[model samples]
Target: MDLAIVILNWNGKSWLEKFLPNVIEHSDESVIYVIDNASTDDSISFIETNFPNVSIVQNKTNFGFAGGYNEGLKNIQHEFYCLLNSDVEVTENWITPVAILFKHDSNIAAIQPKILDYNKKTHFEFAGAGGGLIDNLGFPYCRGRVFENIEKDNGQYNDETEIFWASGCCFFVRSKDFWTQNGFDARFFAHQEEIDLCWRLKNSNKKIFYTGKSTVYHVGGGTLNKQSPQKTFLNIRNNFSMILKNSPISTLLWLLPFRLVLDAFAGIYFGYQNGISHFWAVIRAHFSFYKQIPETIKLRQKSQISKFYQEKWLVFKNFL
Candidate 1:
């Protein structure tokens, strides 16, 4: 098969049972594979017995999202790969538009479909609404989502266009380009790794795109609850590492410190809204980022782009 639809699963038997059929029915032409991150539950057995057609790549231990996919995908060879989330419900003809887009341009390395919320259906999903974009300070947001504000689907983002990154929830990418970037930064473990990979791809002159023609509904926070302090920590820490690895040195000098100040304020807000745990998460994230700086700097490519953001001071523009 030219396309491999790979789902990374870690003790998500319920999600697989709920959404796998929809995926199989709509994606007939593509091969389906479940990369099990050493799930302890009966997930592997259930897939083996009920969905014998679906292939399974079992890892010895849970490597989280980034490393799990990186290890799992090394065995599955195809022209293209769709790194789908287990909780997403894909619609009919979802793969065709992305395939057509990829064929139209060899430089187009990645593409994301319109991701809607599974519960509301009318609103764009939080994970990746319309498409992903970054600010001057390397804060990632979607066209339909800015901070806590989510815009309802009004056909405003129903056109195909270039995007800064594709959602990892339903990411489509050329296999060659994926491997060329050496897959995702396993150091990320999870959260914002897709954006980091897309940034690296952009630095190498590859395009990231989005098509509203295809659609998928995501049940956000399937594995990690949105309120989890761990999620906050991963998001903040991974984002810092991503920016440091991809941003031009000249921009990093000022942008990094400015972001740190903004995050301090954000941490206080999160503490008031969520809990003291979130405030501590932001602190932990910064310390982790500091510790990872040597490793992150070593991973930097030969070139870094200056004009990577779609907007300047998006936080101020959105909230102020």
Candidate 2:
């Protein structure tokens, strides 16, 4: 098959029941696989019983998003791999545009479809709006989202464009290119690993694109709630590691510290607005990042290449 749609599942049987039909309906020409991350629930049985034609790859243990997909992808070999989230309801004919993009340009390594909120259909989703973009200091934003601000889908980003990264929510990556970067960082466990992978691809002069021709409705925060402290911790810690693992040492010298300061302000703001647990989650995330610095820097030394950051100071210009 030209494309394989792989959804990573971790006790998300309800999501599968709700959204898998959309994926199967839209991707009749492509193979579909549910890669289970050792769910204690009956997710595997549900898939086997309900969608017998769909393939399954069961992990021995829960590996979170990064390790789970890394392990699951080893079993399938296709020209393109769509790492779709279980909670995403793909629109009709969603996969064709991305496949055409890959076929048209060999250099385009990855692409994301236009993502709108499933609950709030008129607005862009937070995970990936039009496409993923980053600031000079390695902070990520999107064409339709910056911080907590999600833009209304007024066809503002309808044009297909080259992007810095594609959301893991329903991201499409060339299978060979994915293996070239060694897949997602297993150490990331979950969160921000897609950015790191895209950064590596970008460093090697590979293009990532956002195509509005295809669209998907994402029920964001399915596994982890938006306000969950654990989610906050993972996002904060993993983002720091992503910057360190992919950025130049020269940039990291000042940029890392500046990010820390900015993140500190973020922690304070979260504390002011929410509560101490949210603030402490940020503190805990920084500590976790500090502890992993030596190992993450090693990853940086190995993967750091010349190309990075097409845009700069996006946080200040757009959000701040």
Candidate 3:
């Protein structure tokens, strides 16, 4: 097969029942598989009974996004793998443009389709706007999204472009490139793991991209709410681990400290606006990041590259 679409599921039967048909209908030419993360629900039986043609890989335990995909992908052998989310509803011919792009460029290691919000189809989704880009401070934003701000889709970002990272919601990457980076770092467990993989690829001189021709509507946060404290903790902690693992030593020296300062300010804002649970999530994230730093530095030393960041201090230009 030219490609395989793998959806990582953790008790998301409702999403599969709602959106899986769209994917199968849209991606008739590709092989589709559901990787179940030891769901306590009836997700496995539902897939087996309803979508019999679809293959299923049952994990012994829940591995989150990172480890679950890593475990599931070992069984899939294809030139390209689409790591799709169960909550995403794909449009017709969604795979054609990305397949063509991948066939044309060996250097382009990854790609993300134009992701619109399933609920608000006119607006870009928060998971991945037009495409993902990281500022010098290791903060990732997208052409259609900057933090919580999601732009309305008016064909402004319709052109295909090179990007720093592809959103995990509906990500595409060469199977070889994925294995080369050792797949998603299982240590990440969940949030920002895709960015960490993309960063490692970039450090090794590979490119990631976004193509507007292929579009998928994402019902963001199927597994965890955007405001969930656990989600906040994983995002915060994993982002720091990503920077430490992939950034050059010189950049790491100053950028890491600056990032912590920015994170502190974010904590203060959350404390005032949200509540103590959210505030404590940030504190826990920072403390968790600190605990992981020594190991992260070891990973960085092992994966050291001469250059990394594309735009230095992206906070000032993008945020300020």
TM-scores vs. true structure, each candidate: 0.94, 0.93, 0.93
Q: List the candidate 1 regions with Cα displacement exceeding 4 Å.
A: 305-320
Off by over 4 Å in 2: 301-320
Q: Could you arrange the candidates by TM-score from highest to lowest?
A: 1, 3, 2
Candidate 3 per-residue lDDT over residues 1-320, each given as its tens digit:
37999999998999999999989998977999999999999998998899899999988899999999999999898988999999999998888889888878889999999999999999999998899999989999999999889899999988888999999999999999999889998988999999999988987889999999989999998899988988888999999899888888778889989999999999889877888888899999999999987887767735464333324345446866
**Rank order (by lDDT, best first):** 1, 2, 3
> Who wins the lDDT comparison?
1
Candidate 3 pairs with clashing backbones: none
Candidate 1 has an lDDT of 0.93
Candidate models: Cα lDDT each = 0.93, 0.90, 0.90
RMSD of 2: 5.6
Per-residue error for 10 in candidate 1, Å, reads 0.6
